[model samples]
Target: MSRQVQINKIVGRLVAKKREAVSLTQEDVAGRLNLNTESYGRIERGVTPLTVSRLVKLATLFQCGIDELVLETSTGLTGQAQYIANMLDGVSSSDRDEIVKIVEKICALSHKKHLKSIKPY
Candidate 1:
């Protein structure tokens, strides 16, 4: 399958899994996300693309990170998880590690910047 399709599937499955883990139904998740049931269903099916905003919301609602949702290899997860596992399978270990480091540095820098923006009481 194409990489885009794979990513969508992974993201969709993770969202669905997280939603279910919290005992939330598709309708419940859809309501929280302000999405229609049909649209949300399409997302879970990987028939529609997931937006970054929706990804952030899903991570928050599911108490997970985008990375976790995108790198899962378990079948118990929603279809999205299987897609994530497949996509990650294509990555080189060295490249994955390097990317992780880069992301960590970026997060650290962002945290520092946020701290700098706050004034002392």
Candidate 2:
């Protein structure tokens, strides 16, 4: 796949995962985003390209940044996330929930640490 396509897939997986983490079904996310299930499904599948506006709405809804939603990676998502998402595919639903929590925590801490390292002090 092209890098863009891979990025899209990674973004889609993260969107799907965040939605699930919040106990929001695809239909729920679609409804909240003022999109039909099919349209939202396409977004989640990386079949439809995202507009900046819609991406903002998704980031707001997911309580994340636009970059976090679209950049792809645990860091930016990218192809790396696709492999990780695929590995996560085999985890049972309950275990997956725990894993997601851990991943989110790690991401948050890593982001904080990164910001700290960038300080000129």
Candidate 3:
């Protein structure tokens, strides 16, 4: 399976475990998240992509740091990826998403710069 899929499953299991720890049922979590029970169940099953906004809510609901949700499953991350995750640890998910977009833009610009540096025949 893909790395993303593995990560999603790990995160999902953690979420479900946390919810259980808090003694909340799936219906309770769905209500708090403004999701239907089935949709929330999909998230728990790793069948749905959890949005940053939702993750933020989950962190708040669970009274834990965002890093706590992700850091454990991120054992495979190395160097810069791990650093980036650390930097994003306590940040709001929306801001984190925006930062990712900016990084993507910077990558695009860097690619263009590299192309311009190519020597012409």
- Write down the RMSD of all candidates, one decimal each: 16.3, 12.7, 11.7
Clashes of 1: 3
**Per-residue alpha-carbon lDDT of model 3 for 1-121, expressed as tens digits?**
8888888887788888888988899999999999999999989888887888999999999887676566554445474687677568889989999999999999999999999999999
How much does candidate 3 score in TM-score?
0.58
Best by TM-score: 3
- TM-score to native of every candidate shown: 0.56, 0.56, 0.58
Tens-place lDDT per residue, model 1, 21-96, is 7888999889999999999999998889888888888888877667666666545656655555545676999987
Candidate models: Cα lDDT each: 0.80, 0.80, 0.84
Off-target runs (Cα >4 Å) in candidate 2 are 72-121
- Residues 1-121, candidate 2: write the lDDT tens digits: 8887887777788788877877789888899888899999988898887788888888888776566576545455466776576577668999999998999999999999999889685
Which pairs clash in the backbone of model 1?
9-80, 10-80, 13-80
Arranged by TM-score with the best first, the candidates are 3, 1, 2
